[model samples]
Target: MSKEDPKTNSGYERTLTNAHIQLIALGGTIGTGLFLGVGNSIHQAGPSVILIYIIVGIFLYFLMRALGELVLSDLHKHTYIEFIEKYLGKNIGFITGYLYWISWISLGMAEMTALGIYFQYWFPHLPTWVPGLITIVILLFINLLSARLFGNLEFSFAIIKIVTIIAFVFLIAYLLVTGGKTSFGPVGFGNLAKNGGFFATGANGFLGGFQMVIFSFVGVELIGLTAAEAQNPKVTIRKAINELPLRIILFYVMAILAILLVIPWNKIATTSSPFVQALGATGIRNAGSIINFVVISAAVSSTNSFLYSAGRLIFSVTYDGKGKWNETFGHLHRQLPQNGLILSACLMGLAPLVIILIGNQAFNFISSTSTSMFLIIWCLMILTHLSYRKQTPANKLTDFQMPQYPWLDYLTLAFFGLMIILLLSLPANRMAMISAILIFIILWAVSKIWHQERAI
Candidate 1:
């Protein structure tokens, strides 16, 4: 593919392939939380947490398909923000674009913090912030050097995660065949309906799982962002979008099932890594060490993905006059937005230091705040897709139109709305909800001020 101008942030080398794109999506979606945190969801909803993943995965599949359609319609339009601007009004586009950029930055910070925590497990004597700073520096260097290098790093990170998961699955199957101390014999599927009687937490439990389960799918749409950088946009986009749903089901559903089955729902502890607990139950001697390595890799890969996306989002917003930042922030080196990448990396490293100075409670507060911001961005994406579909000509929508168009779109919107309602009702999430709204208001006011000055 011919390169476009780097000055306008219109072009970059297309270096990613279909496999790279696929693993990128996998890395983004499957994080440490799913491997370690789903126990909380299980505690809340019992075996029915599986059902929640299925439902959310379906809607997200359609949402991504809708986004893919827009991406495929125009190869040059790499970011979803650009699509929003072309189809929706400029104001909505600007807000969505900036909100997304800020949300990802916050997420990158949180992931970096999580990385520090993971590192603490290995080296308790070292200060936590030390590792966080080191991680940021390493990722910045990789991201700044070249887009292809970043892709390769991410690709390898993703492969580590994928291989770990596949190994876990095989181990689970072997445990089932070997016949453990439990009465279910060699191969048991009874875990699905036995303990807590499957849906033990009842309807409310399923509703509660929706909160975090949705969060797990946070960065799946990032595949669209790779369009401009993929070797062949048309082929890569179609292949990635087509396989997303199956990947979600296999990677999420099956893995969670293996976890819950290996250890009873009630017995699993949310505070500890579920992978470690599950492997331990299977009588594996070095399970803890193995799981630690996997979780650490998970945290690093997630942070890397977030940093990449945040940089690109910022570059896009600044190029479009949606944000006030240095023009050099949009500059590319080796087909990557080096300035943006470095800036985001610095902020992420700074987050842990800010938290340590403030307190653990303050750190937790920022993490919650970031989650709420992510929810708002997700809701905006669905809404933007809805508006884009309405404005798009029906005849020209054939490239990769969302299956079950308006109905799926409406249902997805309703699902996100209910999630917001859930957030409002829960005391733990109330601060996050309010903080996100305030951020949106502040961004809107700033946009207004910028527009007024430009008109003069």
Candidate 2:
């Protein structure tokens, strides 16, 4: 609440409770990626998209385990970037931190962009930019309030998504069991195989699914970031990280299965949510609108989360440093990273303009760009964890160890590497992949040149 800038960024209000942390963890994974992007995932992977989720979930679960262990090792640090700075050196940390922040900004842009698409469900005449621009304004106000308020808002949003998805899965299951009819005819599990079988999309299609599947899990690390704001970092993060696989299986795997069972993979809609499409096809009046509302909520919830993260990350990366960039973004206002929050919110506000420039492909392009950046950041994070395990003396190490040690760490890296290879191999994603790497190198050079100027 102090007016002046603090000398350090060591303290943050640990106001997020166990419930807040848990729901935020749940909320992070079930966003526009699952709701809107899944339609694209299904279109590309077919029914085999189910396996894609499981495979990605397992490795990311291991990623979370390693991240949990790292955060618990040092609760004083505000984010994993600091740990990366400690272990991987300042140059890598600086680049990773900024890239991570920009990635979150990109994610917010994607979510905000989707807001317009969702709103068009009800108000077809509404300009796409209006809803997204308005959403950024509103969510930014909510975020600037307090961490506790943000937690509470996210708790409510997460609950809405959780109930809607759970009920949806159950309804679909019941329909399949009792032979209930839809407008598309009786829903059945055979939809999983009827369209050309599980791997109907073939190996190339299956490989293509990995991109959006990775995008879906992009926010899985939110639990780790929230640890610094949790009242009980150890217990909260462990519970969230441990339960991740189950959450992925239920929210992602089952939800997609329910949608596909009702509408075959080849028949899935790509632009809007397949969830809404499935419900609309049920002959239930207002079903698509209801689910569309929920899908809109999911997008807003994620945009809020990303804005929060982007603000904090920008602050974390710039804290205690010199120069105008640090001076502008590093300080806290009334115990919040006001400058960082405003900056991120403003950038996200431009999402509508980007949508205008790119046309309908804006969301996919923005999400892909974000995913490319995260691939780099996640790689650095896993390396940071491995570096932690290597340097810490056995006697000083905490009991909350990442299971399987170095092997899991190496395997996780390989999975991410494969994702990178896949992205670079694709002509569509090649530009984003190359751009991410170039940004990292540029950031490194800029930091070196800046430091040398200071030394002279």
Candidate 2: minimum summed lDDT over ten consecutive residues — where? 1-10
In candidate 2, residue 62 scores what lDDT? Answer: 88
Per-residue alpha-carbon lDDT of candidate 2 for residues 200-318, written as tens digits (9 for 90 to 100): 98999999888888899898898888876788777888888889989998999999989988997888878788999999988878999999999999999999999999999999999
Q: Candidate 1, residues 1-456: lDDT per residue as tens digits?
A: 333333223757777776888788777778755764476678778888889889888878887887887788777775898878776666767787778887777766666665665665568676656666787788887787777777888889888888888888877877677755332233356777676688887777777676667666777888889888887767777888888888888789988888866777777776556777777666667777788788878878877888899888877777734334747775566667777887777777777666687553433445556667767766777777787778777887756788887788788878777777887776766877788888888888887887787788
Q: How close is candidate 1 to the true structure, as a TM-score?
A: 0.91
Full-model lDDT for every candidate: 0.74, 0.89
Which candidate gets the maximum lDDT versus the true structure? 2
TM-score of every model?
0.91, 0.97
Question: Which portions of model 2 miss their true places by more than 4 Å?
Answer: 1-9
